[model samples]
Target: MTVPQSELQQIVSALQKSGLTVESVEDGALIQHGESRVALFAEADHQGGVIVRLHLDLDLYVEEDSLPDILMGMNLLNQGLDYGTLNLDPVDTDEEGEDSGVAFAVLGRSVLWLPDLGVAELDRLREHLRRFEAEVTDAMERTLHGSKGLSA
Candidate 1:
């Protein structure tokens, strides 16, 4: 069951509203977001499962003063819907044969697993994702606003 463009747009909008910018690829069927300059691809398979790919730039790294960079990466994977299990692939080269630095970090950076979640679980997952997004957005806002005070 392929995901509808409208639904994808809604999901992307919801993500963007939470402060993360979203970019669409593959005719708006896939979405990429986050501060690491990574693009995550999501597509529904014929068997009704969603395939998610994390494309990372080799040079991306988190600053020491920022929130635990490892946790931030995990949060991105944990943001997936719980209706079905998510399968992740390790860092690999794209079709053009360019290195993507996409490696499986389990709870750290990359992920590949099956959730076997039901409708209720899916709802719960969606809520969790939204809440996480809100928290991140709030923290970012606070940091930005607080920085103004430092300059003053």
Candidate 2:
């Protein structure tokens, strides 16, 4: 939306009405779906549209030594996905000041104006979030079993 603030409220309302529990954050909303969570932030684009960033966090975790394989699997999985891009996201650290496990995420962004924000668009966004969670779950399971991500 042109006015980022007002449009953000509309987006949050739509999300809540669609059955997702959205909590207002400083800049946007936070949504939790099962074991996965998504943080959506709204910002004004240069063209007067609003850019909504959907950072979907998966429940997948990988140890330090498994980083390489996990990354490869993530890439392979991304190649087969129709939306979002997988990436390594940092997690909490250990007690000895050593880095702990890592989490994978699918980052998706939508740019739309006030006129384009509607039920159909909200549904599309929700669907994409579901897809991302599924892909991450699959990739992690396959990686842990010593597979090279999802087969194309």
Candidate 3:
């Protein structure tokens, strides 16, 4: 179920052709689109399917005191999504602990039948990523500015 090297190459090529700057990693690539950057990798799962993991870091650094409100907002956002999850990522904290900043991110994945996939399949994946990116960006903006719609 692992994606063939050919498919992987196709994925990278498609991204590049779409105007995304891509950097190859071990099994996938890092893609930059406007201010949104994502890392995509394909791997085989135990069920014998290729899973493409799409990860985008929501780099909104908020004050510790605002983390709860932001998390709440993200939870509300997640409840409305068909794909991906918004999460409070712990890796972005500084040594100041609570006095420092907090971070959030969006992660999405989809399974594909490698033999049946082509440019169209890649386009679908890209569309999903684009939607996730927009939602995460808007959610972060709402959280940081204490948008009146968000509840702590």
Candidate 4:
């Protein structure tokens, strides 16, 4: 079962309000805020449960950037993604590609996934995404301000 257009709109609006630049795609939506980019897809399972997948796309401006940072962030994103699933349990998760699933696609950027999440899970995911956006924004502000002071 496909998700209602209204619900999808709510999800998009929630992400946008969280400071992410959102774009609608044929199958789902894309969110980009700060150094992070994410693609989200919503579908229904055989049992009439909704499934949501979040794919993170990380931006690495410098070639010498630490891979560990990227990996760590991805792991955190995955954890956050799973939070959505666990909160909305009683649904089955599609784990065919556990380690390397289409949940995330990194074509020069990092990506992560959150699968088999229902409406409630999506709501929670929206809240979590908003918090993540705020933290990231705050950190960037501090970093920039600190760098300016040091260069002065």
Candidate 5:
């Protein structure tokens, strides 16, 4: 159940075996589950342990007036997370720069060590995704409810 030391390919295989659609992108692996997509990257750190980073795109757009609410929700969501965080980052809502003003995207980020994978099976990893999704969904419904920043 252990993966090759620092080889992301084994991690990709683990994800695939877990019934997730995974693809190796230029920098990391992209795992798609239903409508959610997560990007994973792992590298050997100075401590001799692999550093793992997981990112999920919530795709929740932010508006200027609702920035405060979004920030508040992000903060609250972070409080309940295990190793992940909800962040508001600047993004182009309009690809062609038509008329969409400044927009921010709600993102999910998690960091863990390779040993944390526990036999390299990625059970904790999958749990992290589900936990992140549930918490964010709840925060959006109650914490950031009625805010103009979020879209369906």
Candidate 6:
């Protein structure tokens, strides 16, 4: 028999309480909100604090040859964020990476740093998650499409 990490379990419970579709996995949680699906995990830092990370695979895919433009767009998107990043990487559409035009997807990652993250911090996070996701989505759209979507 094995025991789950208490910290991660607590975080999952809190996120769930916040009305998010959170499923507790071995080392983290998977959340689906609206049209966005997000994965969340927590780890202990070298400084004894905890680092909570969130990730989502965006729906946009582009050819690998556009790496330069993609990188520049991601940089521009990240520059508008409070503390998050937008990145792109090749996606293996098949076993041989064939029949594809160098497909890639934008990945969104956000981190929460806390020395004493617990119920209280999670309570605060519940409200912020909405804003966080919205902010990232808006930034991505504005940077990639040159349209103002929303504001955080």
Which is the leading candidate under TM-score? 6
lDDT of candidate model 5 versus the reference = 0.70
Please provide the root mean square deviation of candidate 2 (C-alpha atoms, Å): 5.1
Q: Write the per-residue lDDT of candidate 4 for residues 1-152, one digit (tens) a residue.
A: 97655445766776666566889988788877556665677665556545556544322221213344544544443454322211111223375654632322222222223343445666677766655545444443453365432110
Better of 1 and 6 by TM-score: 6
lDDT of 2 by residue, 46-118 (tens): 7765667766655455556677766666667667756566666656555554454444333333333333566
Candidate with best lDDT: 6
Instruction: Give a tens-digit lDDT track for model 3, residues 9-115.
Output: 77788878888788998878888867877778776555654467777775444455677676676677777756566665555555775555554443333333443
TM-score of every prediction relative to native: 0.33, 0.65, 0.67, 0.40, 0.72, 0.78
Clashes of 6: 0
lDDT of each: 0.40, 0.63, 0.65, 0.48, 0.70, 0.72
Report the lDDT tens digits of candidate 6 across residue range 1-152.
88765667777787777778988777788888788777888887888877888887778777767777667666766788875677777787755645556677777888887676666777666655666677877777665565532121
lDDT score of residue 82 within candidate 4: 26
The TM-score that candidate 1 achieves is 0.33
Candidate 6: misplaced stretches above 4 Å? 1-5, 95-101, 143-152
After superposing candidate 5, which stretches have Cα over 4 Å from the reference?
A: 1-6, 93-101, 116-121, 141-152
Query: Candidate 1, which ten residues in sequence have the lowest lDDT sum?
Result: 105-114
Write the residue-wise lDDT of candidate 5 on 1-152 in tens digits. 96555447767777788888999999799888667778888876776656778888876777766887667756766787665678777885546655556777778787776664455437766676567656655555665466543332
Ranking of candidates on lDDT, top first: 6, 5, 3, 2, 4, 1
Select the stronger candidate by lDDT from 5 and 6: 6
